[model samples]
Target chain A: MSQAVPSAQRTSLAVPTQVALAGVFAALIAVCSMLPPIPVGGFGVPITLQTFAVMLTGLILGARLGFLSVLLYLVVGLAGLPVFSGFNAGIGVLAGPSAGYLLAFPLAAGLAGALSTVVLRRGQAAAARGAGRMGFGWWALVWLCAMVASFVFIHPMGIAGMMLALDLDLATALGADMVFWPGDVVKNVLATAVAATVIRAFPALALRRF
Target chain B: MNLLDHRPGTSPVHRAPLGVKYAVLLVLTVVLVAWRQPVVVGAVLAGVFGLYLLARLPGEFLAPWRRGWPLLAFAGVARFASGVFGPVPLSPLDALGPALVVMAAVFGALAAARLLVITTPGTELLDGLAHFFGAFRRFGVNPEAAALAVNVMLRTIPWVGAAVRAHAEALASRGLRRGPVRLMGPVLVATVGHARATGEALAARGLPAAPEPKHPGPDYTRGA
Candidate 1:
């Protein structure tokens, strides 16, 4: 324990810190999905704050760590923790139509994160030193990142999965997929706003690369 | 099944090493992917279910099906509609027949994993994973880091619950009220604080909590 290791004082996060950050975000994703306050419950409908947490994870953590975080959550849930949306878990969910979207989470988080670093203009060299304010334009771009990841990757994959698992045609799956659009947009906004606020409060949290 | 739902047992399955159970799960997944024959997959499903009962667990062996019925019903209806209305007009039974077999294979894999979790203690599972990951030390991976993260996650779940309650009460006293937006902001802030604290703790314990700078800072490379 006495070895300072000299790595702790670096501008970038240490390896254990990075891993811990990812784990924290993964837990956050699980808590949001399984939140009792807004339980999706047994309705089997997919809308929940989980997506918000997932988006926030990307916006705050950036690509590599973001993907790692969500992937960790997925692995844990698959290991049988009832950590998925609506408090459901296990590999059985893979058989469900939403399995595609569930599987697409890490990719979506990574893509959103890849876009956020550019959109936020956070530097690669050093962590932001103090509280920093982001403009509405920045928030919009981050929102766009989350939204694009959701619509472009996660939703389409979900539709394709439903098509395969449920044997539905493209048109039918598209209709079902549309139901999530409005809730998702609102969620993306909340996630973006929260991410902006967190960064504002702690500029170092604005997602700089190691 | 939930981790909290684990029931202790002395059955061979329960007594088996996690490595053995994990290997079985891996083999099932690899075989399922490599083969398409429903009969082969279905046979494996039967064996897993039989093992579940043989272990005397406290639930229906068909619990996966029961939990997934809404999805099952929805798929059945959708396939039926497509069969009758599509231009090609195939029989509903014919369409659903293939999907069911495939989905069952998928769930069977899940159930097998669940059985492993249900029979094993959480710590044992974590230890098994830590051991498994330890072999990759040459690859720059810290196996214990992952297991530690999971430990923090499970431990922090209770903290999340407490934070929500405290935040709600504080918000109510000030007449600020609580909605997803207001509620989420502070909760996230708290969780972030939690992360920072955990990072600091890990660092103090001499774990690599922060990454090394690509270009060393002045103090970083100073020699004795």
Candidate 2:
């Protein structure tokens, strides 16, 4: 198992292990979503903190890791793990009204993390290593990348699912889920701020190598 | 194999390969989704429940379903209630049937997964995933890292749950655990810190970008 990389490099979390952790995180999200929540009307979709976990998957795990995590969630759910809102599972849920949203999770996380690598760390890391000026700005890019990812990738798919599943008119679904929009905005901002703050306080949070 | 529910005994269902079990589970789920007929759904549920009994799973193993029942009940009731109060003279019964079936199907799936997880140790499951996804190098992921990540993640589940619980318990012991604003702030701060530390520990040990280890398998791709 040893390689030219230092013990730290050779002993880091392996990719397959990352994939499994993603599944576990997905399960955790499902369990957390099951906790009592701010219920919306007839739809039964509540405002839960699970979305934050999804965001965290991307912000911390990076793009591929984040997507793999969500994928793991889907696989387990498909395998009948009660890892969804309301402790629900099975392929039916994946094809049900909420299926689209579920499908979008990995995308959102991946886009967020991947974009962060580009937007957050790309220029700064190169500069920092050259000039020895690594700072919170790099961390801020990671958060900003996550925010953009959610906006571009996650919410649209969720709204699309709501429209298709509920048979709502696009405009109406958009408006109704506007409630989600505001809350999500808050979640994204909070996630960004929290992520940056964590990285600053613990620079190692940004490190993925062993 | 360690069970999350902590029961013990090896049976065919217990010993089935993760991939085969997953394939069966996927096929059943697809069948359930494709056919919405109550008769079909009921039959499937009945059959799965029969397997459950055959597996000799105790009543305790179904406890997680109890946690979800209230939500299912609420969803069912809310749907019916909307039908009742809505200006449209909607029949509550119409909503009731689909809602119940959906809920039951969901419960069925969870029950099945519970059987799998309870019988399989987390480590063994990760090994299964690594082998299952051993072909991911074509897609740019190092198979070994992917496997390691999966294991790390599974190992952290109990720890994350415990961490969250310990924090909540500490707050409760101090007569706190109120207000989403106040409660989530510390809990989230703690979680992020923990997740980061864990990630860093993995990284410090050369995880994320580590070169793949040698293994006895088909050499599908070059390792870094």
Candidate 3:
């Protein structure tokens, strides 16, 4: 009882706040998919809002709970709810070309969230004067961490899905992976840029409501 | 099988037991996986589309596709590009048939799923899942937390989606929408803080603790 509320001034939030934020992040993933994507090239993979959703879920929800959120989305999709990109769902999707990416959502979210937390802690401590004043280089490092995780974990799973479903060899699959890269990179850059801006304007956006 | 809380009006599919429905969906998915031939896959697609009609699912039910179709197209293109650019040497024409068929099948199945979910309430699905996995207690799993996990996931997906958009719109108002890096940076920060707080809350509530195991033998407790 002597905990004295642990000084809410720090990073963590109360229980109700966490639930509220989790709900908010999940909803953000869904809405991000709804906005029309601007296609980058002939490969047809336009940079959509999915990365922002997955990364934010991980960065905010952490490894376990963040995984839970993406898993829930997948379950909802499997159960026939249209929570996926384009609002499509069902078991058939699990076997299709995109199955790998679909399956990777939770894993990707978990990886990104875990990696980002490390950066967040370090960044917070380093930026001792005024919570909002983050060194630009540190912000760049956080971006690199997120991008690397997505590229390493999510993309490979996605390629495997393509290979298995499409009966393509690794080379062929890599080709497909390349197509998604440019567009995804663009999305990541955009997501990160917007994320930084939000922090600048509403530092509260940087704080967890959960 | 409905995951979202929205159960539609009375229908045979909606009324079916969640376990049975999930089993059927799983079996069908396995069958789809087992059969790779385009003819078989096409047949499955046709059958799924037929089911959509049978369920009386509305055209607007495919509403999410308005935004999603492009992503599917991109993926399809990526598949073909990989085939052509890489050592595989698959003709674009060859890739198109399977890609479109796969996309159609996926969309159809999702459409069917959407109809069912929008109709069924979430609580029913949770209770059904809890009862179905009731035996997992032996593994030190709390059926309640497991069930709650499912519920929270279902509840939050749409929530996170809305938050991302609101953040983006707010950003856009200030004339800031060029790359995901810029957009997601703050969102990530906000998200991490939220996750930590959430974990703390669950801990405070005495969660992460396993529930009592179910009785193992035939000569069980009082209920037996």
Q: What would the C-alpha RMSD of candidate 3 be, to one decimal place?
A: 7.3
Q: After superposition, how far is residue B1 of candidate 2 from its true place, in Å?
A: 9.4
Per-residue lDDT over B116-219 for candidate 2, one digit per residue giving the tens place of the 0 to 100 score: 66666655555666676666777776667555644554555566667667767777889974544455455556655555566567667666555555576677
User: What DockQ would you assign to candidate 2?
Assistant: 0.20
Identify the leading candidate in terms of TM-score: 1
The count of residue-pair clashes in candidate 1 stands at 6
Off by over 4 Å in 1: A1-10, A36-46, A86-88, A122-132, A164-169, B26-42, B65-68, B78-87, B91-109, B135-139, B173-177, B208-224
What stretches of model 2 exceed 4 Å from their correct place?
Answer: A1-47, A60-62, A68-99, A114-148, A159-179, A202-210, B1-3, B10-12, B58-65, B74-89, B119-123, B158-224
DockQ of each: 0.36, 0.20, 0.27
In candidate 3, what are the lDDT values of residues A20-101, reduced to their tens digit?
4554456567656656776666666567677766765665456655676666566555655556665566565776667898
Per-chain TM-score, chain A, candidate 1: 0.83
Best by lDDT: 1
- Tens-place lDDT per residue, model 2, A1-210, is 011212253233444345444645664565455566665447665677677767866776677667777777665555443457765544545434456677887888888877765544454355555654445576566657766777777678867764443333455445545667666765665666655554455444345521
Native-referenced Cα lDDT, model 2 = 0.59
lDDT (Cα, tens digit) per residue for candidate 1, span B59-161: 7466656665655566555655665565566776676665566566656765776687678887776676567567776686666687777777777767776
Cα RMSD of all models vs. native, in order, equals 6.7, 7.9, 7.3
lDDT of 3 by residue, B14-100 (tens): 677777667756665665656656687677667655655665554545653664575556556655665566565668777677666
